[model samples]
Target: MGADELSATLWRGRRQLDFLLFLLETQLLHLRAGNWHRLNFTASELEKVLENLRFESLARGVEATALAKEWRAPDQFTLPALVEIAPPGVWAELLDEHRRALVSLVKDIDGAVAANISILEKGPDEARAGLDDIEILATQVNIERALAAVSEASLPFLRDFLGLS
Candidate 1:
């Protein structure tokens, strides 16, 4: 389901926690299928997505606290602003060789989505004329969709620490 269709049951503060945990479990299915997804949001969109989170009161740099490492208490930022900043050093993180492996995995998911859209828009007959590898295409599409859903329901590190959800 897209953002527009998300019900209050799914988005309410408490239920959202449980939903995120459920999402983490569901992601196991995608992992088994060798699928991973990357979330690429513009600064503004990222801000909007995290606006409701309780990160502000949370102490920064509390392990898994990327924001804390590079920032301080007096230096405040809105969710949108933090999205633009992308939690600490976005560029440095991308530059890491080890992290590149993770990037590649997520890139595969994004590529699958682009392929699916192309197939639908250009019509299956034309898109799959030569490389009509239906099985491979279908697998990628299914895995990609599952990963995207999990990405949307991602949880905070705090939840795990508090044993909340």
Candidate 2:
């Protein structure tokens, strides 16, 4: 990807991360309210948000991989590593140090999601068999998987961008 394309891709990925964070925060609120019905609906909505995140992450990954390949190969037109792609000060300006901040935020969200999953899984034996509860559990599992996917997709990008890995 060209510089502008790469910049756009990073921007889009960050926006998707923001949306995922919002959804998870909302889920936490519903959990705190002990509103199972609303929580169920929130889980359903989270499914949709997760789908969008996956799509965005996938596209971002493709672009980043393309750029990485270019960085590795000897082409007539060289592609720099992500950190070298922009001017010295441009990346720092554009991302505003938030990429590192996002690392922490994602970790916090993962912990919160896991805690909720534990609570859901530990409900009374009688409640476990209900299909609705099972569906909710399944959805929560999917959310966890999606979170992993987002991390897997974005980590390489962040690592290359921040030289963190």
Candidate 3:
């Protein structure tokens, strides 16, 4: 692309990140608000907001999406920071829960997928199943390590989310 187009793409990507941060801040507000009556928009409140939203808000999202496609693909243009929530230290237990849940899912679903697909593709091999089981066990054992990593990654965001700033 030309220099101007590339610069515009970069600008749009930054705007996309800002929009994500806006949504995150709104969510934090909703969560801190307690009940439904007290709080306005948790992410779920999008349906209502969309239904009643002014053209300006609607237009911003559409512009963001179209510009995002120019900037990057429609599937996943935003940075990884938006997907994560809270801080590692502030909510280590929750972080650990997510890690363990992932490991558990991998053990149950991926383990089965590998085992069954390997048998069909590569013939009956005890090693595949045995190693799959080993992987599951190893992931379980490494949960603590994984959680520590998660905490380290999430500290800055956590501090910001909790208004520790």
Best by lDDT: 2
lDDT of 2 at 55: 74
lDDT of 2: 0.54
Residue lDDT tens for model 3, 74-136: 454322221242233433344334334433432333333333233223322332354567654
Q: Point out the higher-scoring one by TM-score: 2 or 3.
A: 2
The Cα local distance difference test for each model comes to: 0.35, 0.54, 0.34
Error of 3 at 135 (Å): 40
In candidate 2, stretches whose alpha carbon ends up further than 4 angstroms from where it belongs are 73-81, 84-98, 124-165
Question: What is the C-alpha lDDT profile of model 2 across 67-163, one tens digit per residue?
Answer: 5565553332212334444446665355444455556655655666665665444443343355586676765664455344333333344444444
Go through the candidates in order and give the C-alpha RMSD of each one to the true structure: 15.3, 6.0, 20.5
TM-score of 2: 0.60
Candidate 1 global Cα RMSD? 15.3
* TM-scores, all models, native as reference: 0.26, 0.60, 0.26
Give the Cα error of residue 132 in candidate 1, in Å: 8.4
Clash totals in order: 2, 0, 0
Model 3 Cα shift for residue 163 (angstroms): 28
